[model samples]
Target: MKKLALAAGVAVSLVLGVQPGSALAAPTSVVLAASQASWDQKLAVAVKFGLGDDFALVELPDRDFVIGIWDHVKDDPEHVEVRVAAETAFAAAPEDTDQLSYEFIITEVYAAFDRDVERERQEAEAKRQSDLARSAAAASIDVVADAALLNGSDADFVRLIWERVADDAKWPKVKAAARAARDGADSDRTAFIAAGMAAAARQDIDDRIAADEAKTEAEKALERARASKKLAANRIGMPVTDELLNLPDRDFIIRVWNFTPDGSEVQAAAIAATRSLDPVVWKAYIDTGLHAAVERDIQIALERKYQADRALAQQIKATATKNKDLNLVYWTDKALAGTPTQLDDFLRAGQYDLDLSTSFGAGEVLPSWSNTVAWTGGIVNVKPICCTLTGPELGVRNEPGHTGSTSLMYSGLDNNTTKSYAYLKSMALSRITVKSSTRLSYWIYPQSNTVRPEVKPANSTCVAIDLLFSDGKNLRDSLLKDTKGNRAHPAFQCNKVTVGKWNEIVVPLGALAGKKVTTLVVGYDQPGNTGGYRGLIDDIKIAD
Candidate 1:
């Protein structure tokens, strides 16, 4: 049967003479009319029935308290409890019955009871929300940690509880249990926490067994992650433990183990990684690396050959005809065809009559900014700005050439925001003979882009090479370029030029027909702020 509300149930029980049962259960109301009486109406009924004071004792405008009282006191129709309450009110009045008012007392009591009921309801709701939050926090402990707690490895479980359940009512019990597991050896820790779990679950040792099992699984996973991390470092070629540069080979990298191997998981993984690579792949890698070493040796050999051929170059330059001098021609051809697969292709490219350069060739010329050689043109300043020159000689060893040419490192820059130019020229070399078939060529190695504002600047914003030639009468800028193609010059920059490596720049004499030339100038010009622009010059040649 559906029960009526507290006040209504109490009122109906009173009006219909139904005896109240226990504190928890009230009988179903067959009469809905009395059960639905208003609060003021119920107060009036309680006053008229001479139970107004007893009603106030309920501390709420509800019938549960009344039902409880009925169980304790109600035995007759002329209820002694109500009579005693009324007599007590009268006796305490100190006035006659006419002055006594149970109605006013019941009204105040009913209002106070309503407030108390609301307060109690609010308190109960707050408690419920608090419990929900705490429960959620406890359940939110990491699954890994939870399993750890159930098993014997309770470190994660202890830390999780400390973080989430610090303020919980049940925290102390679990905290002590987790602390025991965390602080003790595996067996002792599990035994203590399991004992606590046994009490909370109010069961036997099976709960403890489950906890121990869960802990074992969580710990196993932790160990595996640790091992994998250490192994990953080895796979990527870092130190598996102490030494990185030299590590043991594949066979020594890992050892198979049947058990947990307690303190050696990472060691085992390192060994396994090395073993995995022991077959044909590692040998292939070693073979591939040998190519660079072989290439370096080849460069050394070529430089020696070049040094031996300098006297030969002078002899050939003085006498070789357009198609003769096979030795000089053969070697020159080889020098130009870079890194060819066959020696024939290598020996057929740099066909030249002159290799008028240096591997800084057998001399220690001092670095002089002033050009003292009368045949070699002096450094000229094109801008109104003053610039400083560093080395145009042999002894300054700052930058190195290909096979150590004792390179020319020239930088002519200042702190000026205006333009400046400092360049090396070959104005006096008119008598060094080249036949009608002659062209000038040399290798330019870049530490920076040779092109100006378009390419990235290394130090100087402008770098260029110019050849001054006489159209039989006046010397003019015959070829003006900075290693990039310029149609205006029409002599140099005949093809695409790349920087950061040696580039063979070849200029045919036919391009300068009816012209006599003496000067080859390399110039640096710029608005100067980043100073010290440097380039490497090597194996300069005038060949047929």
Candidate 2:
């Protein structure tokens, strides 16, 4: 009869599509299955007959059925509360049919799930806060490290480190070590940052245990000795080694003495410190004396450079005067009269770009000889029948002048005048006087192409100058030679003239040194050419 009832309940559950708490119309069809029925058959009858709240207990004899339910709902998103509760109950008694019952699955599973969810939320929030705190701590550590490196004061740096990490629980060992160094002697603070803080930080990361604090006095003294040797070696670019670190105090000082340049301040200090044979002296020299000596050495080197620069400036000034480059002379004078920086500037580039001809001294300007009309003498002579001088007018041009607002230009056309000659002469200047030491200097710009001649004593420069005297004598017959050693009568010839650039002509009155000047003349004589011609002149001065 139990088997028949169980089969009939399963059949009714399948046909009616009923759930666990549905109402049934026929009481006979809804009869409860017997105790020996399988759990699925009992569940089917409970669903078909709506016996969820019945007083009689449904016998779930097989524990696998509840285990299957737990496995199915454990990962079901819609049954999170039931899944967690079921997990809890299964953990407590996985094989106990009483705890695995449907009644416990609906009630305790949801309550346990809620509690676990809240616990996970709190843990996630705590981890986020910890990450943020670590980030902030890292930034603060960077700032403090930068300040320490720049300040160069080990004691103050250690104190700052202590204050920064004092309340930070993550760096407990670092904080303690920094505090001890902060309140200790200056050497203690220096030693801490040099090595102690790094070791403490490593220990804190590995395990939060107190560091060893039982260093013997002798051991501390030995550490200080090694650190001092290393610091000195590093400062002087000497390699630090175990043998160097273990040297006797005097021998160590001797090593530093040898490492420095002979006769250097550091070497002298090292020798003095070594003579004392005292550890305190050695420490003091390493800590402060070496730095002071190095500074003194630098000042000495700078003083030597200053002296050398002054000597060089004097030499340059003399050379500038010899070259007759007044621009260079002016700049050198400024350098001599100003600071060392100005002297360096003059040597570097200031003297190279300025016009040397514009600044003249020991000279006299003749206002009557200022323009082209004073020198042209109203004469334009052109040779050869085919040659014609189209223009010989004098005008002022703004550029290509040696000095002043405008230069005197004399222009004319050749008109196919091959092997022709043209000349311009100055009117008589009987009012001007010449002395034995008199010298005439002027600059000229020739606007023509210069060609080398195939044959002939005369080159193709086509330019010359002559000085006339009161005795009707010219420069060619006189003993006067221009600064270039060429006779003043034929100044520009044989590559001596530069075309398209200003050229200076200086004539010293050698034979006619103390005579009155009659006239000044300029000429063009190209042996085998014909074209337009132009030239500029400026800054006519007489010097001695």
Candidate 3:
């Protein structure tokens, strides 16, 4: 019978031109009037008229009707819990007409309203806590900013203020303002400290409230900013302040200290400056002290070099004396007597280039016929039969020479008379041919102890070079001119001879053109006040 009643209800809905069981479908005037009545009135009419199963088809109400009720109460504070519960239930059976019945909806809404109410209370409390945290942070920043305003030049104090709100994510405006103030001009910094910070902080708070951001996230953001700022500052060697504007000065001093030699004056000055831990001291050192110390250090190095060069010069002088290198010995003596620069030059290059040597051989002078002879009066005599007087002995000694290891040395007693003469000569094996362009060149070193003092300075007539030709002619009477315009016999008169230095003599044989040179002689005459006489001769060359 119930099945029959349900079929009958559906049939009646269909005949009325309405979708069966569709409450949204337009209904007849009787059904519309019935739907317009209250839920209680509709129920009473159905029971009184014995509507039976056809009551279901009467289009009592659907999801749209429940949705309307929900909308009305959803925002009502007094019924917030109930509205939330109804919303949950309605949403579950929005399309199921059986589950969306008024009785089921009302029962579910009232039953779970208390749980929703408790949840709402907890959420409100959490929001309150978060608000308090953000407010507290902002208040702390305000206090610091107020303190910073009092001393603008106090970098530490200003830094403290910046640190508090430098990169607060919950306060982006505040962070930006702080950065601008920290890095900007004095006026910008002053403005931020005076009022800009507070305004920016307030803006941040409003932004946070609007976004409903949690306080825990704000704390984490603050920590991240602090870590990032510290890392960046450390990596870049920290930002400069008003007092420490010259950063390069500090770096330069540090490099000097590190790179200079350990016990040096420059290094010492750099160490003292750096260790003082005063920027003023560093600046002073860079400006004045460092340069002064460096100059002193250079002088010290020069002194050390002088000492070393002097020692080396002494060693070279000794070697030159042993080798009879008069040129080397002369330069070494000069270097020792002069400045360190001269000594350094001699040691470095002068010793090798200045020392003279000869290519002439010992075979050119017949050793067996080489002898020394002295004459009482200033007479040119080559024969041994002359006034009997002890002449200086001729020997090869390695004491001083212009060009060779050994020179023909004349040493022994001499008559203390101005007219006395002593000479050493080497007779050639054969008469050597000569051309008009041929010249005789030789170096003479006169010992200071042997030569007369009067002849040692301007001109020395005592020293002479005599050549004997196979034509029975000699240079003493010949009109042959030396490199200087003086005759060959009086060579020392033409050239000034220093006692301790080598003197050169050159005689052009153009006067004896085509003459054959048989003998060569270097002699000292007029031993004015001598007890003994000594001299050296070297580099005997008979070339054109």
**Who wins the TM-score comparison?**
2
Q: Which whole-number lDDT from 0 to 100 does residue 158 have in model 3?
A: 40
The best candidate in terms of lDDT: 2
Better of 1 and 2 by lDDT: 2
> What lDDT is reached at residue 15 by model 1?
29
The runs of at least 3 residues in candidate 2 whose Cα sits more than 4 Å from the true structure, single-residue gaps closed, are: 1-225, 336-544
lDDT of 1 by residue, 1-544 (tens): 1222443454433322213441211123332211222456555545544556654433433333333333332333234323222222221111211122232244423432343344355446534433322232233221222333333224554455555545654344455555665666755543433233223222212233345555686665443333332333322222334342233333223321221133343344333444555544333222222222223433554455444344333432332222122233334444433342232222222221123333433342222222321111222322221235243321234456665636654444334445433444322222223455665665656555443332233543244444433111111133323223442221223224445776666655545543333334455544433344445555555545
420-529, model 3: which lDDT tens digit per residue? 45545443212245676777887777665435432233223346667654333456656666786666654334235555677777877776775544345555554343
Candidate 2: tens digits of C-alpha lDDT, residues 189-236: 755654466446544643432232466667656766665565556545
Q: Which stretches of candidate 1 lie over 4 Å from their true place?
A: 1-359, 363-399, 414-418, 433-436, 448-461, 469-476, 479-484, 487-499, 527-530
lDDT score of model 1? 0.36
Give TM per candidate. 0.26, 0.30, 0.29
Clash-forming residue pairs, model 3: none
Cα lDDT of all candidates, in order?
0.36, 0.50, 0.49
**Higher-ranked by TM-score: 1 or 3:** 3
Please give the lDDT score at residue 129 for candidate 2: 34
Native-vs-model 3 lDDT?
Answer: 0.49
lDDT of 1 at 208: 38
